[model samples]
Target: MADTYPWQDELWRQLAGREQHAHAYLLHGPAGIGKRAFAERLLALLLCRSPQNLEACGKCKACLLLAAGTHPDAFALEPEEADKAIKVDQVRDLVGFVTQTAQLSGRKLVLVEPVEAMNLNAANALLKSLEEPAGNTVLLLISHQPSRLLPTVKSRCVQLACPVPDEAVGLRWLAQALPGLSDEERGELLALAAGSPLSAARLQEQGVREQRALVVEGVKKLLKQQQGPSQLAEGWNAIPLLLLFNWFCEWAHLVLRYQLSKDEQGLGAADMRKVVQYLADKSEQARLLALQDWLLEQRQKVLAKGNLNRVLLLEALLVKWASLPGQG
Candidate 1:
């Protein structure tokens, strides 16, 4: 069985120890919060041949099978590719799996992660399976954005919310999880992740910190007439489109915050603070607000549809960003 995060220990005990568990569970939470790992641990506890203290006995046949990812009675479903939707055929296969008997004699388990990735057709296909309460089967649906799921699908299952930990707790966990990080780097990553420790660790591992530094510097150079919008956009072509937009949105919010309160606390990532402050001082307050709205709108459009021309959209935003200083 995979070990769960410290914050998940209480919830794990509650769900694992319960004899009358729900047939379907909707575990909803922010991304990178370890909900999938928690669900896996619970699934293992359910399938263990000889459970020990409401947890899995790792030496059991069931545990060994699950560890090997060859468990006959268990199925894991998710998007076949990154940024793709889960198709109706996948749910149809799940429906077929649900109607069958458990081969392990203990119970059958199905794990669906990021369930919101399922399209309308796929979600409708899953309703019947969720409605049928089987005696020896459990369905675990993990969602980062539960609001995107159909209400009918959500209403059928028991909902378990996993919340972001407090700043101190998140930073403490990050400190141990990423031992090489300096205190400043740890704090910046935690803030950027909005107090999700696992997300902060992933950001560091993915070099988002370095990318953000480059982006911030690019913004400064754009305002100072040292770089052109097309040049900056081309240089930023390697950064994920949504991620770049999100950072732009965050920086814009900080500019607005500084305009409103003249406080430094509104700034984000420590490395970007100087650049954000520079923009806040030189840019028009009203223009900053309008640009912030534009960034938010573009971010939404990009997220909803994947077919947009990334380079052109980014170039347009950078052009607008470059004009901010003179707009004042």
Candidate 2:
């Protein structure tokens, strides 16, 4: 069974309590907020031969089949490789599946995760199935970045915006999810994950805190002239490029914010507060703004999965960052 989150209780009630289900639903939210799990739970309920209290009956034949990944009336479409586009051919296959009669004579269901992974051609192909709904077929489309989706595709489905839990709620859940970590540690993780609790848990598992500490130390050293950009860039080879970019982008934002507001409380995480303040005091706003612009441009390339020379990119970013402190 898909794990039901505490934060999703209201959303589940609203969705499951519907008298007539829509032919398609677009569940859009930030990544790691359990939208996929919510869709899975809904799919199970829709497939269950006998549901109790707006939930799937665990003992039912349909539930058993789904648990075993052998559901004849259900299909899940995703990229064959992680972070790759869902090919047009794959959508074509799904279109064929959409037209077929369900073996169980029940509602046919299809789940597509991160729907923005489909490029223009693939998305266009999916429109065929969306336009002509076959008998008792329901499609669940999940997207982390709905802005990338075609307007026509967005128009065809019932759009449900998933919620991001507040800090207190997230911390409460993190307490259970990561009992081994101290409250402060979990809080830092949550902050690092940008308030996405599941993402915080995932970052903990991925050793993101450790990587962040290393990067933080390196940044301090770079500013102090103790470490060169090339050395630090090569040393950080194990860390993910996107993660690095995100942290730098965030730090740049913090520096700018502090420079403008002089709000010490807005210095962000404790580990980098001093560094952020130092940069804010010493760096010219114009230089910081230009650096942020460059960071955003490069971040886009990172997101698009362009063929980037990671070491070179990191070196470039560090060189620019290292130059920030003495600019004023």
Evaluate all candidate structures by whole-model CA lDDT and list the values in order. 0.85, 0.93
* TM-score (all chains, Cα) for each model: 0.92, 0.97
Residue-level lDDT tens digits of model 1 in 218-300: 88778778888888889987788988988889888887788778887767667678877888888888888889889988998
Position 35, candidate 1: lDDT = 89
Q: Candidate 2 has which clashing residue pairs, if any?
A: none
Give the TM-score comparing model 1 with the true structure, all chains together.
0.92
Q: Pairing residues by index, what is the TM-score of model 2?
A: 0.97
Q: Tell me the spans in candidate 2 whose CA falls farther than 4 Å from its real position.
A: none
Clashing pairs in 1: none
Q: Which candidate should be chosen as best, given TM-score against the real structure?
A: 2
lDDT of 1 at 324: 83
